[model samples]
Target: MDLKSYFNQLTTKERELQFGRKAADPLRHAFDVKRVVHAGMNGEMVPPPLAQKTWQDLMHQKVQGHPTQMAYFHIPFCKTKCLYCGFFQNGTDQAAEDAYIKRLIREIEMDAALPRLSGAPIQAVFIGGGTPTSLSPENAGRLLSTIQNCLPLANDYELTLEGRIHDLVPEKMDVWFKNGVNRMSLGVQSFNTEVRRAVGRLDDREEVLRRLQTLSSYNQCSVVIDLMYGLPLQTQEVWQDDVKTLVDSGIDGADLYQLDVFEQSDLHVYIQKGKLPPAATTQEQSAMFSFGKNYLEAQGYKRLSYCHWARNNRERSLYNTQARCGTHLFPFGCGAGGHVDGLSTMLERRLPAYQAAIDQGRKPLMFLMRQSPYAPLAEVIMGQMNQSRLDLQKLIRMEPRLKGLEFLGSLWEEYGLWQDNGYLYQLTEAGQFWQVNMTQTLLESVEHLLGGSSQIHQKKVAAQG
Candidate 1:
């Protein structure tokens, strides 16, 4: 039978019976497949020159408005590339890293001097990368020192240093803690050595555990480990074991993500060549996800957001939360992405281009403002859903444009995507599984209602130029 015929054979109730709560492909119904939206803080990039007017306008508005609370610094260097990675990064080179740090510090100093950012107290600073911890201790310290001296920080500011297990020695972490870095996001991926090796992650499981234990002893800092599901050779048993080990290891928080095989990644190449075992099927992955959710909640971990769980309240992911909530972010360094005053921006991806821009005294921004009139509503909706809850009335009230979109709540309710308890709305487990797809559906519907999606204003600017 053809694919459509096969799907048509099953009724909605029958499909529910077969797949249980979550569909095999949660975004897919019998007749249609929903497209997931990449409506994060950043979107499609327009050349920096094309965005100059908009950039200046937004900067003026930003200075006149409330100060942005978060900033992100990208360190795009890695010791070795992982098989499933698709981020901009380069292999370790000491000289190149030193050069990058010097340029980054200069960029920070320049940004700090902007009248637009004057007196804007930064509440959170996220140092993310191919691996920020890959930098030498001296460079890392210099970077931290530069942030401290150049930027205005809130008294309770959060500084998160994202790292890998192999690079996280006590000495380096000590320097970070002393420099007011209070959070660590360690990329553990999986605790199974075979699975790790299959993905080109070479850290020993025992050593990772040891490092976690040692880091946990730093009462001044919180350690959050990232775990992945649906990886090659990852079984339900292995995933369960990984979760149990993480909880028992006494880490502050954990984030669970499904493995995505990008076309440019080495993992995709291995899959194409049949050199690695197949990844878990969609059904199997859904099962693993459900199991993880239940297991972690059972272990007294509070589900802070959809994928994040914390042992206690101290592990708030300010960067992730703020970014998702459409908060203004100042992006620094090569390939960093952020949103400021409604205009999405990304820095130059190539290291040389980025350094040259800094040398010539530029912000290194690639502008790509969200064009859709409903973009702000879309952002707010997705952000709330990411936390697994939504206040329908408040959402509508927040944006006048969203008032007419309230009818979407009824449609979603009919589809069992969310439950309305008179005052508030929350996604069901199945809804949570398909939240991204649902958010996209709503945003698209809004776009369709508003004549059509707005075209990139930069194209007009380019034409005029």
Candidate 2:
């Protein structure tokens, strides 16, 4: 059956859910709510019986052709939990951290000699966490040194240290630079002191700028930060000022994000109970998204991805862009996740299980997934949509059935979300704001069109009604 026939088979309500309910303000009102935090279709999880064998079999073989590759290291310790963060795993304790670092180094060593890892050049290395910067200089140094010694990093590798900016002191800065970290991605969700403190971010606005300046002054790495829109107390005025501050801060790049507050999260509860002001609605965030994009483009900042902007050649944001396109990522540290060959694995997030597994000379796997047959097509959808463009021709060439997806481009274009520029559909400012939604919907539609009916979930997040 053709895609249209498949789509037609769904009930009216399901069609509305899959495509959208058209509205005057399609960018916000077209969908009932944002569907997800990030966009991609689900893959079948590998059962426990086959998980270890899959890992061993994949690791035993050499990577055939050169593919863009990267590594992810998770540091699950944070000194203070930011109210809005979802990745926080554990609080920082000196003794726990010391032991964790030792275990992490051992984990790195375990994979060092494997031909699948050691034989190829790693394009990027991202050390992310509850707060990687929360690590003491000693632990940070130990981790960074081990990475340099263990991974076969590419000569032009982009090593990014991802964490909160509280550790921007000279001590941590020196450790990062000494170990060949060429990039740093710090979370500075807001430059509005009121907004920050309301959400448990310790540093005030002035201190944030000062520390960022300190890091940039080192001139050793591409210093990037994450700024969010639609937080409680982050009014349009405050949001504009945040953008202005970023331009003046002279940092290399930044990701201007629209905040997603889960209903179960502290931020959501606080606002609901009147402890904090309401966050911006989805429509309001759309306006903020347009303003930020326009302002950054006006300032000659390159739009590296939908939300990410680069001030110069310094911030490549390689790992983020490439990982979505099926780069082989070596996961390390507890709570880390990666994909190898066609399998995706998440290491044990629980410290005890992770330590026990590693101590027994086993990969600390929590779950392993075999990528669905649709993954390659989903990757194409995600990678292209992330850059605010989608090449229908590429999809059609990849699989003729994907031509049906073009109808989506047509509909979204009419909604003022995108434009046809010859061979590709370039997302408008509105489309970019709603990229995650569109990407998820399209991925599900692809499955429904080519296979069977699939459920598309619409979630209630902070910005959504």
Candidate 3:
């Protein structure tokens, strides 16, 4: 049978099972599920670029009054590429890595002088990458020092350094803490050694736990560890153990992400060639996510956001929260993505292009800038939904096009996906499981209502021109 018909049939069966005599209409649910699945299977959509003049205009307006909340630096070097990653990353070359840091610092200095960014006191700075910790201690220190010298950071600024377990040595952590980094986000996708090996992540489980213990001892910096579900060899027991261990390890926070096997990633190719096991089914993955959410909440960890849990207010994830809320994020380094004044920006993905731009005294290449009229509202909706709650009335007030979207609550309520408490709507357990899909469905519906079409408006940057 064709995919549409298959989904229709599947939805019908699900409705019968889910509600029996009280089964509501399943057509919309089926259509939404199909769209969600299709989107998940597709590759990342690169937004089209806007002209440099447009970017400059937006930056000018942004600087005049817009509050700068976050800044991000991307380090694109990794010790080894994980099987499931599709990020712009290269194998660690010490010389190339050092050179990249130098160029990054130069870019920072250049940005500091820009009239559009002058005197903007940033509340958060996120040093993320293929693996930021892959940088040597000296290079990392230099990068941090450059940021401190160039940018005006808020007094209570949040500085986060993203890394892997093996790279976060005690000495390196001390370096980070001393340099104003108050948070460390480690990618410990799984504590299962077998699962880690299968996905090209080489870390000893005992050593990882030991490092977490040591990291927890550093009261100056909060620790947030990432755990992944739906890996090839991940079992429910193993996934539960990962969550339990994280809670008991005294880490400040944990972020649970589902394994997303990109089509271009090694894991996808391995599965296609029958060289690796298939990922868990959607049902299995949903169960795993639900388990993690319930277990974490039960452990006194507050679900600050959909995927993020924190033991206290110190681990507020300021950068992520601000970025999601459509606050300005200044981008630095190759392959970093940010948004400012309604224009989504991305830096050059290639190291040579990024470095050459800096050498010529220009901002790194901006390959994409999404300046759609509907983008702001869309971002707000997506961001709020990602947080597992949405104030329908508030959204309608923000964008009148959302006036009739209240029916979405009814549909969601019928399917047990959301709770409508008459004042605001929040995602129920089922809705959180299908959050991404539901968010997409809502965005598409809003687009249709606004008579907006998803068209890429491409323009060449002045540097490229």
Winner by lDDT: 2
- Root-mean-square deviation (CA) per prediction: 7.0, 1.5, 6.8
- Candidate 1 residues 1-465, lDDT tens each? 322233346577543322223334442331122123243222455565667656655555436556556899999998888887777478889999999999999988877876655557888999998899888889999999989888888888889999898877877887888787899999999999999988878677888898788788878788998999888888899999999998889888999886655555677778778998777754566677788888988889998777888998889887777777777788889999877765677788899989998898877765566544456777777788888777878766775555555665765666667789888778876677666555555555445445444211111100000
The collision pairs in model 3 are: none
Total clashing residue pairs per candidate? Answer: 0, 0, 0
> TM-score for model 1?
0.87
- TM-score on alpha carbons, each prediction: 0.87, 0.97, 0.86
lDDT of each: 0.73, 0.86, 0.74
- List of clashing residue pairs for candidate 2: none
Better of 1 and 2 by TM-score: 2
Error of 1 at 465 (Å): 44
Residue-wise lDDT of candidate 2 within 158-237, one digit each (tens)? 99998877888888889889998899999998999999999999999989998888888899999999999989898899
lDDT of 3 by residue, 1-465 (tens): 221232244455443322221223222232222123211111223343445556556555436665756899999999888887767468999999989998999888877876666656899999998899888889989999888888888989999999998886877877777788899999999988898988888877898898788887878888998898888888899898888888778889989987765556678778878877788755566778888988888888887777888988889888876666678788999999877765566888898988888898766756645555677676678678878888889889987767767666776677777788888888877777767666766665565566643321111111100
Instruction: Give Cα distance to truth, residue 191, candidate 1, Å.
Output: 0.7
